[model samples]
Target: MVWLFAIATGLIVANLYYAQTLIGPISRATGLDPGAAGLIVTLTQIGYCLGLLFIVPLGDLLENRRLIVTALLTTAVALLAASMTSSAHLFLFAALCIGLGSVAAQIVVPFAAHLSRPETRGKTVGKVMSGLLMGIMLARPVASLVADAFSWHAIFVLSAATTAALALLLRARLPQRQPAGGMHYFELLGSMWQLLKTTPVLRRRAAYQACMFGAFSLFWTCVSLELTGPYFHISQTGVAIFALVGVAGAIASPIAGHRADQGKSRSTTAIALTLGAAAFAMPLLIHSSRLVDLGVLVLTSVVLDMGVSANLVTGQRAIFALPAEIRSRLNGLYMALFFMGGALGSSLGGWMFAAHGWTGVLWTGLCFPLIALCVFATE
Candidate 1:
C-alpha cells in the first residue's frame, strides 16, 4: 500500500516537470522570446502554489479518496489540453492548470502521513517521498527522451492517458478518510496564517526546504541548456542518460527518513545543507579535460540531488510529526513556500543563464543552500 502511494506520487508530480527539459524546443515552436522562456517553468510552479493554497486545504474538509481522484482527473484534462494547443498563450494556460491539478501529489503525501502509525511515520513518509523524489529526478530525462523520439506534445499526451488510468486505480484502492468535523472552507484557509504565526517549527522547516528546493530548481532549469551548449554539446538522448545516472540520489530518501526517526533530523539537515552548497562549487574547482568535466557534472548532479532529496524527507518528517488533524494544511503550507522558492529559482535561472552563462547559474545555485544554512543556524 505504501509502495502504491509512492508510485502514485511519482506519476502525479511528473506532470509539473515535463516542460523543463523541453523549454528550448517548446519556446521555439511557440515563438516565445528565448529570454522569457523560463516563465514556462515559473508559471507552472505558480499555478501549483495557487492550488496548494486553495485546493489542498480541502483535503482536511473532504473525503481523501474522492479529493485525490478529482485532482487527478483535472490533471488528465489539463495534460490533454496542453498536448493539443498550438498557441503559446493557450499552452501556457494549460500549463497553469497542469500545475494546479498536480497538487494531487501534495495531497497524497499528507494522506500517507495520516495513514501511518506514529512509531513508523517517518519511515512511511520517507518511503513515499522517495517516489516523489524519483518523479522529480526522472521527469527531466523522460521529457527529453519523449521529446526526442516524437514531439514534446507526445509526452503530455502519454501523461494524460496514464493519469486518467491511475485515477481509476486509486479510486478503487485508497482507503476512505474524512476529517472529524465540518470545517468551513474559508475558515480552513484563514487558520493557515495562525498556524504559520504560532508554529515556529513549521516556519523554520519550510524555510529550510524552500531554500534547498530553490537550488534544486535552479540547477535543473539550466542543466539541459548547459548540456546542449559548447561545454558538453550533448543531445536530448545524452541528457537523458545523465539524468538516469542521477537517480542514484533517490537512495538518500529512505536513509534520511530513518535518521529523522532516530531523532537526528537537525544534524541530518546540517549535513544536507553543506553537501548542497558544495555540489555547485565542485565544477569550478575541476577545470580539466572534457572527460573530467563530464565526470564532474555527473558527480555534481548526484551530490546536489542527494542533498536536496535528503533535506526534503528530513523536513517533511519533522513537519508531519505535528498535529494529525491539520496534516494536510501543514503539508500544503510547507510545500507552497517550498515551491515559491522554486518559482523564483526557475525565473532567475533562465535570466542568469542568458545573461551570464553557466558561471552565473552555478554561483546562484550555490548561494541558495548557503543562505539556507545561515537561516538554519539560528535554530
Candidate 2:
C-alpha cells in the first residue's frame, strides 16, 4: 500500500516539472522570447500557489479519493489541452490548468503523512517525498530526451497518458481515506492565517523553504541560456544531462529521512543549508569548464536537494505533531508559501539573466542560501 502510494504520488507529481526541461523547445516552437518562455513556468507556479491556498484546504473538508481522482482527471485533460494548442494564449491557459492539477501532489504528500503512525510519519512522508523529488529532478532530463526525439507537444501527450494510468492504478489499488471536517472552508483559511500569525516555527521554516527555492529557481531558469551559449553550445540533449546529476540526491533522500527519524532534523537542516550556500558558489568558480561544471552541479544538487527535502519534512512533522485537527490547513499554508518562492525565483532568474547575464543570475542565486543561513541562525 505504501509503495502503491509512492508510485502514484511520484507519477502525478512529475507533471509539475514538464516545463522545466522543455523551456527551450517551448520557446523555439512557440516563437516566444526568453522572458515569455519564462511565463509558461511562472504562470503555472502562480496557478499552483492558488491551488495550494484555495483547493488544498478542502482536503480537510472533502473526500480524499474523490479529490485525488478528480484532480488527476483534471490534470489529464489539461495535458491533452496543452498538447493541442499552438497559440501562446491558449498554451498559457493550459499551463494554468496544469498547475492546478499538479498541486495534487502536494495534497498527496500530506495525505500520506496522515495515514502513517507518529513514530513513522517522518519516514513515510520522506519516502513519498523521495518520489516527488525524483519526479522534479527527472523532469529535466526526461523532458529533454523526449523533446529531442519528438515534438514539444509530445511531452504533454505522454504526460496525459501517464496521468490516466496513475489514476487507474490509484483507484484500483489504493485504499480510500476520508477527509476530517474540523473547520469550514472560510474557517480553514482563517485558521491558516491564525496559525501563521501565531506559530513562529512554521513561519520560520516556511520562510526558509521559500527563500531557498527562489534562489533555486533563479539558477535553473537561466541555465538553458548558459548551455545554449558559447561555452557549452549544447543542444537540448546536452542540457538534459545536467538534470541527471540531480538524481544522486534523490537517491540520498531515504537516508536523510532515516536521520530525521532519529530526531536529528535541526542539525541536519543547518548543515544542508550550509552546503546549499556553498553549492551556489559553483557557477561563480567553474564558469567555463564543462567537466568542472558537471562535477559541481552534481555535488551541489545532492546537497541542496537533500536539504530542501529534509527541511520540508521536518517542518511538516513538527506541524503535524502539534494538533491533528488542523493538519491539512497547515500543509496547505506551508506549500503555498514554498511554491510561491519558486515562482519568484524563476521570474527573478529570467530578469537577472536578461539584465546581468550569468554573473547577475549568480548574484540572485546567492540570495537564497544567505536567507537559508539566516533562517537557520535565527531559528
Candidate 3:
C-alpha cells in the first residue's frame, strides 16, 4: 500500500511539472513574450493554491476514494484541454485547471499517513513522499525528452492518457476511508483558520517549507531558461540531462523520514536550511570557467534538491502526527502556504531573469532559504 501510494504520487504530481521544461518551446510556439513565459509555471502554481484552499478541504467532508479519483479524472480532461489549445489564453487557463486537479496528490499523502501505524508513520510518510519528490524531480527531464521527440503538445497528451489510466486503477484498488468529521463544508473550511491560529508547530513548519519551496520554484523556473541562453546554448535534451542529475537528491527523502521517526526533525531541518543557502552561494563562486560553472550548477542542483526534499518530508511527518480527523485539512493548509511562496518565487524568478540575468537569480534565491533559516532561529 505504501509503495502504491508513492508511485501514485509520482505519476499524479508529474502533471504540474510537464510544463516547466517545455516553457521555452511552448512560449515560442504560442508567441508568448520571453519575459512573461514564467507565468506558464507560475499560473499553474496559483491554480494549485486555489485548489488547496477550496477543494482540498473537502477531503474532510467527502469519502477519500471518491474525492481522489474525481480529482484525477478532472486532471485528465484539463491536460487534454491544454494539449489542444493553440492560443496562450486557452493554454494558460488549462494549465490552471491542471494545477487545481493535481491537489489530489496532497489528499493522497495524508490518506497514506492515516492508514499507517503510529510508530512507522514517519517512515511511511517518507516512502510516499519519496515518490512525490521523485515525481517532481523527474517530471522536468521526462517532459523535455518527450517534447524534444515530438512536440510540446505531445507532453500533455501523454500525461493525460497515463493519468486517466491511473485514476481507474486507484478507484479499483484504493480502500475507502472517510473522515469521521460531520462538519459542514463551510465549517470545515472555516476550521483551517482556527488550526492556523492555534497550531504554532504548523505555522513554523509551513514557513520553513514555504521558504525552501520558494527557492526550489525560483531555481527550477529559471534554470531551463538559463540553459537555453548564450553561455550553455543547450537544447531541450541537454536541459533534461541536468534535471536527471538532480534525481540524486530524491534519496534524501527516506533518510530524512527515518531520522524524523527518531525524533531528530529539528537538527535535520537546520541542516537542510544551511545546505539550501549554500546551494545558491556555490554558483556565485564559479565564474572563471564555463565548464567549472556547469559542474558547480549541477552540484548546487543536487544539494538544493536534497535540502528541499528532506525538509518537506520532515515537515509532513510532523504535521501528520497531529490528529487523524483533521489530517487532510492540516495537509491542505500546510501545502497551501508553501505553494503560495512558490507562486511568488516563480513570478520573481521570471522578472529577475529578464532584468538582471543569473546574478540576480542567484542572490534572490539565496534570500528565501536565508529568510527560512532566520525564521527557524526564532523557533
Candidate 4:
C-alpha cells in the first residue's frame, strides 16, 4: 500500500514538471516570447497553489479515493489539451489546469499518513515522499529524452494516457477514507486560516520550506538555460543525463524521516538548511576547467536536492503529528505556501537568466536559502 501510494503520487506530480526542461522547445512551438517563458512553470505553480487552497481541503470532508481519482482524471484532460494546443494562450491555460489537478498527489500523501500507525507515520510519509521527490527529479530528464527522440508533444500525450490509467488503478486499489469532519465546504476552508494562525509549527516549517523551495526552483529553472547556452551548449540528451544527477538526493528523504521519528527534527532541519545554502556556493569555488565546472554543478544539484527533499519530509512529518482530523488542511496550507515560493523563484529565475546571465541567477538563488537559514535561526 505504501509503495502504491508512492508510485501514484510520483506519477501524478510528474505532470507539474514536464515542461521545466522543455522550456526552450515548448516556447518555440507555442510562439511564446522568450522573456515571458517563465510563465510556463510559474503559472502551473500558481494554479497548484490555488488548488492546494481550494481543492485539497476537500480531503478532510470527502472520500479520499474518489477525490484522488477525480483529480487525476481532470489532470489527464489538461495534459491532453496541452499536447494538442498550438496557441501559447491555450497551452498556458492547460499548464495551469495541469497544476490545479496535480494536487491529487497531495491528497494521496495525507491519506498515506492517515493509514499508518502513529509510531511509524513519519517513516511511512518519508517512504512515500521519496517517490514524490523521484518524480520531481526524473520529470525533467524524462521530458528531455522524450523531446529529443520524439516531439515535445509526445511527452504530454504519454503522460495523459498514463495518468488516466493510474486513476483507474488507484480507484480500484485504494481504500475509501471518508473524513469524519462534518463541516461545510466554506467552514472547512475557513478553518485552514485558523490552522495557519494558531499552529506555530505549521507557520515556521512552511516558511522554512518556502525559502528552501524558492532556491530549489530558481536553480532548476535557470540551470537548463545555462547548460544550453554557449558555456555548455548541451543537447537535450545531455541535459536529460545532467538531470539524472539529482536522483541521488532522493536518498535523504527516508533518512530525514527516520531522524524525525527519533526526535531529531530540529537538528535535521538545520543540516538541511545549511546544505541548501552551501550548494549555491560550490559553483563559485571551481573555475578551472569546463569539465570541472560541470562536475561542480552536478555536485550542487545533488546537495541542493538532498536539502529540499529532507526539509520537505521533516516539515510534513511535523505537521502530520498535529491533530489527525486537520492533517489534510495542514498539508494543503503547507504546500500552498512553499509552492507560491516556488512560483516566485521560477519567475525570477527566468528573468534573471535573460537579463543578467547564469552568474546573476546563482546569486539570486543563493538568497533564498540564506533567508531560510536566517528564519531557521529564529526557531
Candidate 5:
C-alpha cells in the first residue's frame, strides 16, 4: 500500500520535470527568446512553492484522497492547456497551474506517513523518495528523447493523457482518510514562523536540506554547461544523455531507506552527504576526460540522491512521529524552505558559471555541502 503511494508520487511528480528537456524545443517551436524559457521552469517552481505554502496545509484539514484526486485533475487540465498554447504568456500561466497542481505529491508523502507505524517511517519515506528520484532522473533524458522523436507539444499532451489514466487508477487504490479538525489558513501561515523559531529539529533539518538542495541544484545547472563546452563539444542531446548516468543514484535510493529502517538514518544521511560533497571534486581533479565526467556524474548522482533521500526520510521519520494534526503543517514549512533553496541555488549557479566558468560553479557548489556537514555536526 505504501509502495502504491510511491507509484503515485513518481507519476505525478514527473509532470514537474516534463519541462526540463522540453524547454529548449518549446522555445524554438514558439519562437520565444531563450531567456524567456526560464519562465517555464520558474513559473512551475513558483506555483509549486505557492501550493506548498497555501494549498498543502489543507491536507491536515481535508480528506487526503479527495485533495489528491482534485489536484491531479487540475494538473492534467493544466498540462492539456500547456500542450495547446502557442502564446508565451499562456504557456507561463499553464506552467503555474501545472506546478500548483503538482503538489499532490506533498499530499501523497504525508499520507504515506499517516499509513506507516513509527518504527518503519524512515524506510517508508525512503521508498516513496526512491520513486521521486526515478521520476526526476529519467524525466530529463526521456523528455528530451520524446521531444526529439516527436514534437515538443507532445510532451505535455502525453503527460495529460498519462495523468488522466493515473487519476483513474488512483480513484480506486488511494484511501481517503479524514484527518482531525481543520486548520485555518492564517494559523497555517502563522505556524511556519513558529516552527522555524521553536522547533529545534525542524529548524536544523530544514536548514540542512536547504543547503544540500542548493548544492544539488548547482550540480545539475552547470553540468550541462561543462558538457556542452569545448572540452566535450557535446551537443545538448549529449548533455541530456549524460544525465542518464544519474539513473544509478535513483536505483540506490532504497538502500538509503533500508538502512534508515535499521536505526541508522542519521549516520546514513551524513555518509551520503559526505560522498555528495566529494563528487564536486571530480572535475577539479580531472580537468578534461569524458570518462571521468560520466563516472563522476553517476557517482555524484548516487551520493547526492542517496544523501537527499536519506535526509528527507530521516526528517519525515522524525516529523511523522509528531502529533498527526501537525504533519501537514510540518511538511508545508519544510518544503517551502527546500524549494526556496533550490531557487537560490539555481540563480547562484548561473552567476558562478557566467563569472568563473563550470569550475567556478563547482567551487560554489562544493561550499554548500561542506556548510551542511558543519551544520549537521553541530546540530
Candidate 6:
C-alpha cells in the first residue's frame, strides 16, 4: 500500500510540472507570446493553489477514494485537451485544470497518513513524499527527453493515457474512506482560517517549509538559465542529465522521517535549513576551471534538493501528528502556504538572474534558508 500510494502520488503530481521545462516549445507551438510564456507554468501553479485551498479540504468531507479517482480523471481529461489544442488560450486553460486536478496527490498523502499507525505515521508519510519529490525532480528531464524523441504534444498525450489508467487502477484497489466530519463544504473551507490562527505548529512548520521551498525554487529556476548561458552552454540533454543527479537527494526523505519518529524533528529541521543555506554558499566560491565550476553547481543541486526534501517530510510529519479529523485541512493549508513561497522564489530568481547574474541568485536563495533558520531558532 505504501508503494502504491507513493507511485500514485508521483505520477499524479508529475502532471503539474510537465509544462515547466517545455514552456518554450509549448508557447511556440501554441502561438503564445514569448513575453507571456511564463503563464504556461504560472497559471498551472495558480490553479494548484486554488485547488489546495478549495478541493483538497474536501478529503475531510467526501469519500477519499472517490475524491482521488475523480480528481485523477479530471487531470486525464485536461491533459488530453492540452495535447489536442493549438490555441494558446485553450491550452492555458487546460494547464490550469491540470494543476487543479493534480491536488489528488495531496489527498493521497493524508490518506496514507490516516491509514498508518501513529508510531509509524512519520515514516509512512516520508516514504510517500519521497515519490512526490521524485516526480517533481524528474518531470523536467522526462519531458525534455520525450520532446526530443517526439514532439511536445506527445508528452501530454502519453501522460493523459497514463493518468487515466492510474485512475482506473486506484479506483479498483483503494479502500473506501468516508470522512467522519459533519461540516458542510463552506464550513470546512472556513475552518481552515481558524486552523491557521489557532495552530502554532502548523504556522511554524508552514513558515519553515515556505522558506526552504522558496530557496529550492530559486536555485532550480535560475540554474537552467545559468547552464544554458555563456558560462556552461549546456545543451538540453546535458541539463536533463544534471536534473537526474539531484534525484539522489530524495534519499533524505525517509531518513528525516525516521528521525522525526525518534522525536528529533527540531534538530532535523535545523540541519535541513543549514544544508539549504550551505548549498548556495558552495557555489559562491570562485573556481577558474569551467568544468570545476560546473561540478560545484552539480553538488549544489544535490545538497539543496536533500535539504528541501528532508525539511518537507519533517514538516509533513509534524502536521500529520495533529487530530485525524483536521489532518486534511491542515495539509491543504500547509501546502498552499509553502507553494506561495515557491511562486515568489521562482519569480524572484528569474529577475535576479537577469538583473545581477548568478551571484545575485545565489545570495537571494541563501536568504531563504537563513530566514528559515532564524525562525527555527525561535521554536
Positional deviation of residue 104's Cα in model 1 after best superposition, in angstroms: 0.5
User: Number of clashes in every candidate structure?
Assistant: 0, 0, 0, 0, 0, 0
For residues 195-297, could you state the per-residue lDDT of candidate 2 as single tens digits? Answer: 8898887787788888767766666677767777787677888778877776666654566666777888788777767766776786677654677775666
For every candidate, C-alpha RMSD to the true structure in Å: 0.9, 1.7, 0.7, 0.6, 2.3, 1.6
Reference-based lDDT, residue 163, model 5? 85
TM-scores of all predicted structures: 0.99, 0.95, 0.99, 0.99, 0.91, 0.96
Q: For residue 345, give model 5's deviation from the true position in Å.
A: 1.7
- Predict model 4's lDDT versus the native: 0.95
Better of 4 and 5 by lDDT: 4
Clashing pairs in 6: none
**Candidate 4: tens digits of C-alpha lDDT, residues 151-249:** 899999999999999999998999889899789999999999989999999999999999999999888888998999998999999999999988899
- C-alpha displacement of 16 in model 4, angstroms? 0.7
| Candidate 1 lDDT by residue in tens digits, 1-379 | 8999999999999899999988999998888888898988999999999999899988889998999999999999999998987788988999999999999998899998887898889999999999998998899899999999999999999999999999999999998998884679999999999999998988998898888889988888999899988878999999989988888899999999999999999999999999899899998777999889989999999998999999999989988998888888888999999999999999999999999999899999989999999999899
What lDDT does each candidate get? 0.92, 0.77, 0.93, 0.95, 0.76, 0.90
Name every residue pair that clashes in candidate 4: none
Best-to-worst order by TM-score is 4, 3, 1, 6, 2, 5
RMSD of 6: 1.6
Please write out the lDDT profile of model 3 over residues 1-379, one tens digit for every residue.
8999999999998899899878888888887898999999999999899999888888888998999999999999999999988889889999999999999999999889988999999999999999999999999999999888999999899999999999999999999987787888889989999999999989999999999999999999999989989998999999999999998999999999999999999999999999999999999876868888899999999999999999999999999989888888889999999999999998899999999999999999999999999999998
RMSD of 3: 0.7
Structure candidate 3, residue pairs in collision: none
